[model samples]
Target: MSSPRRRADLFLDPADDPREGGPSLGDERATLTEFLRYQRLTLELKCSGLDAVALARRSVEPSTMSLLGLVRHMADVERGWFRRVMAGQDAPPYYRTDTDPDGDFDGAVPDPAVVADAWEVWRAECAFADRFVAGAPSLDVTGDDRGELTSLREVLVHMIEEYARHNGHADLLRERIDGRIGQ
Candidate 1:
């Protein structure tokens, strides 16, 4: 029997990723925020042009991750960090619960409405995160993350890291769905 197709074989050249204007070098705050924004856009770009069926496809056998699930998970991440932790607002999770911890991935059904709602919630959470960052007095501002003290800079950096990692998964997922890969 022939070997299964490898997703890694489908990667487009790294240079093919759409280049965003690099963050400003002079200002520290501007650099952090711009980099975070670029990472966020990268995730969006990876998911663009995909349909519900493609978005809901899991990765190779063991992992249940899907592009739609990533979007949903990120929405909850943004809300959890910015609204619930940083802002100290009592915001409920968008897709997960204590009992159904994997709801984001498990609930990613292949339907147009589900796809649309995933994007909607993701965008809303991103907007809210932007507002929270913009309104903060300074990067040094601290938040209580369940007993640990965290700063705005820490959260922003964490967010950038989070998006970067997930976007890599998105790259593979998109390529697996369609031989299209890259930025």
Candidate 2:
């Protein structure tokens, strides 16, 4: 019998992955944005076809890292680096509090409404970040992050790294949930 991971439909063929590196390379901005876009998409792909219960499943005990929690956490991350730090807006965290700093992940319950809300907020924050990056005068534009002046370029690189690391976690989590795995 074929294992679920070997099921053709559960995983995309390697040749068809959008993140597959191409022969041609673009400028720094394009390259960074493209990488970030695919990393974000990978997170979505990892969590695809799962219900709220599956989305919020913490297969790794003592760790609150669920797919749903990742989404909420990324939303807060996007809002912080882009809106609060770069855009100089007073935007607070979407799912964090002083008393509950890990609210994003801890509050990732298996509720349909919570899942939907997390997706909505995450998407909105992503859109905001895209606009902010596109409209920035230069990647060298600096932002004050807790008394440290950081450039947009640094933030972009950091974000890409952050997503890539989390996506690795997502891959393991997805595999635990179902034998599905790829990319």
Instruction: Name the candidate that leads on TM-score.
Output: 2
- How many clashes (backbone N, Cα, C below 3 Å) per candidate? 1, 0
**Tens-digit lDDT string for candidate 1 (1-183):** 999976443233556655455756747678888888888888888888878998999997787799999999999999999999999999989899999999999898899999999889989988998898888889999989999999999999999999999999998888888877654
List, residue by residue over 1-183, the lDDT tens digit for candidate 2: 966744424567778776677334888888888888988999999988999999999967799989999999999999999999998899999899999999999999999999999999999999999999999988999999988999999999999999999999999889888878746
Superposition error at 136 for model 2 (Å)? 0.8
Q: Which residue segments of model 2 deviate by more than 4 Å?
A: 1-10, 15-23
- What overall lDDT goes with each candidate model? 0.87, 0.91
Looking at model 2, report the run of 10 residues with the lowest lDDT sum: 2-11
lDDT of 1 at 151: 95
Listed per candidate, the RMSD to the true structure in angstroms reads 4.0, 3.1
What does the lDDT come to for candidate 1?
Answer: 0.87
Query: Which 10 residues in a row give candidate 1 its minimum summed lDDT?
Result: 6-15
